[model samples]
Target: MTPRTPDAVTVFGPDFPFAYDDWLTAPEGVGSIPPEHHGAEVAIVGGGLSGLVAAHELLRLGLKPVVYEGARLGGRLRSEHFGGPDGPVAEMGGMRFPISSSTFFHYVRTLGLATAPFPNPLTPASRSTVVDLEGETFYATSLDDLPDLFREVADAWDGALDRILHLGGLQAAIRRRDTGALKAIWDALVPLWDDRSFYDFVATSEEFQALSFRHREVFGQVGFGTGGWDSDFANSMLEILRVVVTNCDSDQHLIRGGADQVPRGLWSRRVDDAAHWPEGTSVESLNGGSPRGSVTGIHRVRDSAGTATDRIAVTDESGETREYPAVLATCQSWLLTTQIACDEELFSQKMWMALDRTRYMQSSKTFVMVDRPFWNDVDPATGRHVMSMTLTDRLTRGTYLFEEGPEDPAVICLTYSWMSDALKMLPHPAERRMELALEALSHIYPGLDIRSHIVGDPITVSWEDDVHFLGAFKGALPGHYRYNHRMYSHFVQQAMPPEERGLFIAGDDVSFTPAWAEGAVQTSLNSVWGIMAHFGGSSPATNPGPGDLFDELGPIRLPD
Candidate 1:
């Protein structure tokens, strides 16, 4: 097997194989709009990463972007500081980023932010990994050091993927950027796997069925890459295959300051090459240094003859309504139905069904600031670090330790769980969640006093409970591929009726690969192209956008 290189693979899409990175970095820039629409305000409904990315690019393309954010900037890329501005932060959401996310890294590097390898289970970045399951504990620096059962389970997964999904060939095609080979392989698998669940694939596979049930259980509890996969067992196999083929699970890193910096940076950073705006102009400056209040309603303005026009009217919380040539919605799909009152005519019934059926997975993370990286202290009897990066079937499914410096305070993600595991702590408060996490860890490290190292109050978040964001990210279920296709392809308005045009949607949920920042960045670029085309703009001859090649390379439509 070929060793995976961080730069070799990217989220270039088995669904839509477009080189967004090249298009973005093109010398000609994203594209140019007509002089008539140079300063025409385009309403951006959310201030999250997707919204901010689209706003920044639109600003550079000579469009006036009026950003409206309900709660705060950064959305799911939230990082909460424990003490002062310079204090340690608890990443409430989006802590790890895979190096395969090239488009996302484009923004990260452009913003001058720093990053380091995340301490995933058994990774070299982690000093050691401790796997505790069924009240048994094992410590290992590498996979080779673990028991034979561990290696057997790992081999079974590799064998199953290669035999069933043609993992190696598919990944090779992705790495080579061979669109023909990619589409040939992926389009066939889409129909075959989209209607099946991840668990079904594992259970029905010859490799896993030949092994004991214990091996399958162990595989789910301590899965490859990040951690457990049992939570995602019910998700469509297509979703799991995308993650594996794109390398979204491995070679991950965390931003030095926080993940939130990417969005906040895009919001404040001045685009010196802006077409119409001044040299120091930014998304923040264009929106008066802060975004407008929450959007209350989105309606279509009609002419005196009662015919819908091109203008879309957006009403803010303050009761002020403004008309814009285009409106980009980057908020959670459910919000369009729950919080905002969107006009029925804005989207077709099929598109509305897609939006309403989009499912979001639940997630909860608890963090605590420690006095120092005390976990590095070694135990005389065991000759191992006091406590290593932990993965367990216990309440605390995963625990990650972060160190800034020996002298500076550190942060520990006591628990990071998704789906059912996240729901276990949903009803608890921050302090209680920390207590439960500590109690779970105590059982693994018999005498380790993790609470003694704590210096600040604990921070916790259950994304589902937050009304602004109903869930963490989209987790497509079996038989929902058609719905996903509808949402993802909505940006191309060339075939849409006049009433169904102008309002665009971009976010990770609307993408084929959700829960990754790369999806948000890619979808935002798609909307940028869609909005530019709506305003009589065209891509450079040297570099065409996603919409330019969308018809030829768009996702395969699954029969309804």
Candidate 2:
């Protein structure tokens, strides 16, 4: 792999599109503290899944964790509102959960959050010519359907599908050193699986033949090697497939308002005297001595309405100083590393050097509410039987039409993944996403007329680059989990000398589980346990701490 350029700056596109230099300031500041705020024990950063989980877990274990969030709770699990000038409810982020998420399932039960089964596409927009030229879009519905979907796309594609269909006895081959079966019909697959750009993989695969002009987007949109091969972040196309393919029995689910309901339910049931908003906002003041140059106090950051009042700030509204023995960070790992000052370094030189391993990008979202359920034929281009796929010729692949509002059942969303589509989207600085969504939807449902079936205009969300670390609710890049296997190393660094365990990690970012409520709970449990262990206690096996996060291991296959 070629070396990727280092980028510490991200220009927010729709939300806060300014360069880092504009708003970013060193965590270090030469300021004095107020006289009121003081503290002890652990401080948790971010109110997102990871942060809240860690805080609640610590609280469950009889530990007092002072939680600091730049924004209100329910991080990315937020609800996007529309309608009536006060914003009617709609989903802007993660809309549903899959059945394969067992951990998440148990957590949902524990929280007692009401759920409805995930919905399938009522309309089709996927281009069969792109995904697979085989049969119909439902070909993806079952493994046996592969031949149908693979027939005309490409010999290479068909051969790959045949190889997949021949999964018999391969379980035994997994343990074995070699298997000729993989190469029998899949000679072209290994190369593509290992390194083909999503775009090239689709173009060259039998799937592309499945597409038609009506919907060439569904398949073409998902695969892209855009910024050059080096630009790809992690290798997880096959893994993503695993989630879908292996999840045959696992149906999906959606909450009423937003995904945030899961976390809110958890908080409402557990945690004592949880100091959440709705009453007051802003952390007025702080009263603490600087550990080093880092300010260990209540943060007085702004809230929902962009106001600094009423919202809970780390300190009093006026700015006060406080202290904690340790702090658990829950947002993106980079946020805690850069935004907050932790006098000590939790990672070694080697780990620090590899910090360049990850990169993030902007993905825009739009939710449109309609008067009636608008349906369309599946796109022949991508070969999928879903109405959510865009039938437009524009760049930036649109989203898969998964489900609709179970209650209202009249709203829909379109996700434009800029990084995935073989082409980048138009550079319309202002209404880019909204315009795209409206235009694309109109291509298929010209009758509903967005202005008519649409109960409300589109609500846009351009938050990928916000400091709140708003958009990364999905899984982390591939190697973050494998390479940083030893979460114990984090505790080790804290245990070592000057820095101590002042900085704690929280959030779904740290998990064998991907981005979901379950992963957040596990991350929180393990992180809290790490703190408890320091104070003298052990963690549950199911929820291992840093010890598990960074555990080193021996190689499986040696020099062959």
Candidate 3:
């Protein structure tokens, strides 16, 4: 738990390298359970990506997982249609995903989903970018086009990464799946950074401190990987390092149809060749073609046989109770604290602290469908696109454009704001929010008649207002490392008493790096290991599961 010095950062490896994809692809199928318990039922409390991924994996391993969803299947990966069922859509939650998310991309590629590079600020997908701050505006095709101050800021960030985090080496190690090399670097950093803030890392680093304050301001305004990182300033430095080092915030792409397809596909995907069930067995079929209603209560119960082992009794919104040998709760952590009537004995006091303290960031997205990609039109005089992908200090923090084609409708994310900016628009109606966004943009694009191209109704979301999910995603505040440690490692059920061992938690919030689908996938994989072991099933010898190596490479825990 003590901070260590005199170590080099190598590439970070995947937390679990057991490779579910490889095991599933093999003909032998990951080792199955005894014939008597081949079809044991397990309850999955959410139909989001994490729950769906766990259910799918369990199904492959011969477990019957009944999924219960409160609202929708996709959860945060929701895509809202503007015109029709097959019309242009807006990604309300997780739109862009990085290629480094190997586990998540496994499903994406398996489903044969199409993807295109996300135009992140000044990236290649964007033809041009407009940076507006403090009533000043600048347009650029790439980083080199920006003022020299931006270059200084970028170089300072790169220097900080190399000197403090060793991002390139870590990413390379991750890509190679070199666990030893990754652990050597990450173990050294966990204690030094777990308690530090992202702003502290930037403001105190000699590389950044040597630069002008204006440079730091510009850096916060348009961060290299994700624009306007000021929202993340108060978060744990460990969280920030995890994002940059693992390439989670860079080289991202948008799922072509919708990000929702990943979850929905897993639910409907028939495993005709599954190890346990007969042909045409899918999660949808197992759940009778739809998920059970929202889970309302969860409590521990003893078996009728009076065995020492514990079983979980779950009550849904309809007041119906069902008993299962095990349950996986994947809903937002806050829901467990507020919506669900969970028994105190279900989790330890330390675990409750983690779940109750989990912080979720506020986010608001406003999208408009346009007649075409009018933003792509070149200005007669300036020769730049009429309106570039925008990053601003205005009410409209970030603007993105997605064009299906010149003939088809184009979608524009008018504003994607977080934290304080998100709160500003929370009280306003979607139309009012859009009007305020246009007012702000009109100042940036004075000559362009943006309203003339509007085609369909606008779509908007304030994640904070959703009853199902109180906020957008988990954002680890400074000094929350201990809380995160408890949540992320909840899959190690052996540490819990027998009464609590049968219940598990899995979701993006329970991951080391939250707000990324990669975290969700990896944590779900961990729960699969926990649940498999709970049922006396083990991973194939060829690929030792994460739990098999948890003691050696689990998260580096700092002293309380």
Ranking by lDDT: 1, 3, 2
Best by lDDT: 1
lDDT of 3 by residue, 273-327 (tens): 6667998899999999999999999988765786545778899999999999999
Question: What do the candidate models score in CA lDDT, each in turn?
Answer: 0.92, 0.42, 0.85
* TM-score-superior candidate, 1 or 2: 1
- In candidate 1, stretches whose alpha carbon ends up further than 4 angstroms from where it belongs are 1-7
* Stretches > 4 Å off in candidate 2: 1-40, 84-88, 120-250, 270-319, 344-346, 354-356, 374-396, 399-409, 420-432, 446-448, 470-483, 486-502, 512-518, 539-560
What TM-score does each of the candidates earn?
A: 0.98, 0.61, 0.95
**How big is the positional error of residue 1 in model 3, measured in Å on the Cα after superposition?**
40
Give the Å shift of residue 85 in candidate 3. Answer: 1.8
By summed lDDT, the worst window of 10 consecutive residues in model 3 runs over 1-10
Model 3 residue pairs with clashes = 11-169, 11-170, 11-173, 12-170
Cα displacement (angstroms), candidate 1, residue 415, comes to 0.9
**Model number with the top TM-score:** 1
